[model samples]
Target: MTVDPFAKGGLHQAEAILKAHGVDAYFRSMAARTGDSHAVIDGRKVMLAGSNDYLGLSTHPAVIEAAVNAARRLGTSAGGSRALSGTLDLHGELEERIAAFLGQEAAVVTTTGFQANLALSALLGRSDIAFLDARVHASLLEAARLGWGRVRRYRHLDTAHLRELLAAAPDDAGRLVVTDGMFSMDGDVADLRALRDAADDFGAKLIVDAAHDMGVLGNRGAGLAEHCEVEDGLDLITATFSKAFASIGGVLAGPAGNVHYLRSNARSILFSAALPPASAAAALAALTVVETEPERRTRTLDLAEGLHNGLRTLGFDTRPSTTPIVPVRFADLAAGGAFWAALFRAGVFTNLVAAPAIPGGGAMLRLTLTANHDETHLATVLEAFDTAGRRLGVPRGPDLPPVRLTRGDGRRAGRR
Candidate 1:
């Protein structure tokens, strides 16, 4: 009667397979901290090649100080849900700060990025249709399922497919187009201008999940809309502070009326507890750093470029990456596990993305770069990868079936 999915199902089988391949890299608890960019795993000081701390501000003195100060001043928790007694001054300040930063009329903070995406629950009516990108985060998919709207999935980063789907929808149907600013695993960017054109032509509201892009891209660090110069074209933008901001919370920013509507009707935000004061303060501090320190983002992207080129030179397939996230494709799951084990031995830790996370049955090493990582770190990582591949006899890049480019945008790929 008490069946555990992880113990008895597909995940279990995958675990067995990984174990057979001698991969001990899956879930090691962090025992000690070696700054934001490095972690002590199994007592070995390894660099975090798979972390989401893009700007590496998690360990910044200012960010930590702000969190500590807030905790000291205002207790730990928010004490209640936003709809109840949980709303705090720090929350409002962060919301305002985020709204201004993103050039939005208003913003509402949520406890998690997943919950922030659930704002669609309030916006998607029974007669509405949600056009989703295939490579979007699972949160948006869950939101579409929870909402009253019908969901239609288009190819990842493919505005042409999105346009076709939109054209097929009922003319009177409320259209909501959803996509990621930067795909988490693929590391590719959405052509916002092209997407905006498609949405506008089809009379749709555009919603972007900029979880990986916020505080990482754009000249002003406002995420994809700003980076693509389509801020005015977007109807709503949702993102988490966990990545580049080095904080723990999410925000939904858009028009004043839309935000107010979501705040009032989105059950995910209304019923759930509000973000803690410490998180809010830390996010505020991180935002300040993100604004003042443009070099962090520049360094981050540049490092990613260098690392990506290095991987290519080593014959690893980094698929369609234009962001800090780079995923190296492998022949199969077993090859990936062996590579992971080898990298772990080499004192570099990277995440392994396998089936379920992806549509097709394959594995990829999903590594992300941060601003704090330098040339030395890059060299170490590249060297480790080289050793792992050569020793494991792993299949290299451009040899696999590439995501065929359909349009001139060069970002059109992904399917179910």
Candidate 2:
């Protein structure tokens, strides 16, 4: 009775499992869509709450035109690795632009965020001990494993635990502490100040993956390291252009020597083809937008406040967060699934997070707010949440006061 892995019943197992958990999830086939607040999902125009276009620059005319122009000039693809034949002037230009914007000495753009982390780890992690945050993005964890490093994980954002680990390691041991600037699922900023201090005290290098914080934080979208005034303390910073940049590529920024060293050592970058000409151009344009349009940051901050305030008022436990990523927590998976479906019917779409993504018995509805969202759309989304909460029989509670960002006191300052 050797059954094929591709058998009909076997193929349907995933669906059945989802149904059992009261989640009728499907990979939606989206039709033509814009990058603004609205998008076409399976022929229905829905207000986009899941997109990472925090600055709404993906469809900007300037960005679009830059991509078109680059494609016309440099063709569609780089065709080879940068070491071989893929290195184009456009690549260098983009790297330099990104480095300047982030106040780094040098930079390298890779195929994706995963690849960037992989490259960094493969190049720098061989003999080093990597101290990772438990809730860090999977890419960094994978990179550490691929690098064959001695990886130790600390509790999420727990600097005390990290300090204990650092204290135990030998002073001569090469230590690298890595974490996500803003936890994607919980939308909470990392305690960069504490991490930096720990790294300095332990004589370790600090690396931050600001994939979600870039272009969504800081006065000029410089990310959490800069927002925390630890830019000088950070030894390396890796981020993706896909989020707020509205392009497809990952960037590694640090000392010029390190960037130069990675170019020849990282297998991921040495073998894979370079980013397309258009994508590089689009990232440059998006960076420009993030620089010139500070209002986008203000508006998005307001939207995040509104959503956080509204969700708490509806009696959902949104784990302590101070960014655009808002997670509405549920006691069980069943309720989380039902709430998601009900919210969809109410004309809102959000990510349903469970199990491994969120460590615990509970689940979450991860909602992201973008600068493209207006008051009208925000109101609609809030109403949908209200309806879903009622349908799910979640108790309503008094609105908790909003978490305000202060100038210095080291809590929730300047976006990150």
Please name the candidate that would achieve the greatest lDDT relative to the true structure.
1
- What TM-score does each of the candidates earn? 0.93, 0.92
Candidate 2 TM-score to native = 0.92
Backbone Cα, N, C clashes tallied per candidate: 0, 0
Q: How would you encode candidate 1's per-residue C-alpha lDDT over 332-406 as one tens digit per residue?
A: 888888888888888888998787777688888899778888999999999999887888788765643323221
Residue pairs clashing, model 1: none
Quantify all predictions' global Cα lDDT against the true fold: 0.85, 0.81
The residue-level lDDT of candidate 1 at 215 comes to 83
Superpose all Cα atoms of candidate 1 onto the true structure and report the RMSD in Å to 1 decimal. 4.1
Q: Candidate 1: worst 10 consecutive residues by lDDT?
A: 404-413
- Runs off by more than 4 Å, candidate 1: 1-10, 399-416
- Cα RMSDs, all models: 4.1, 3.3
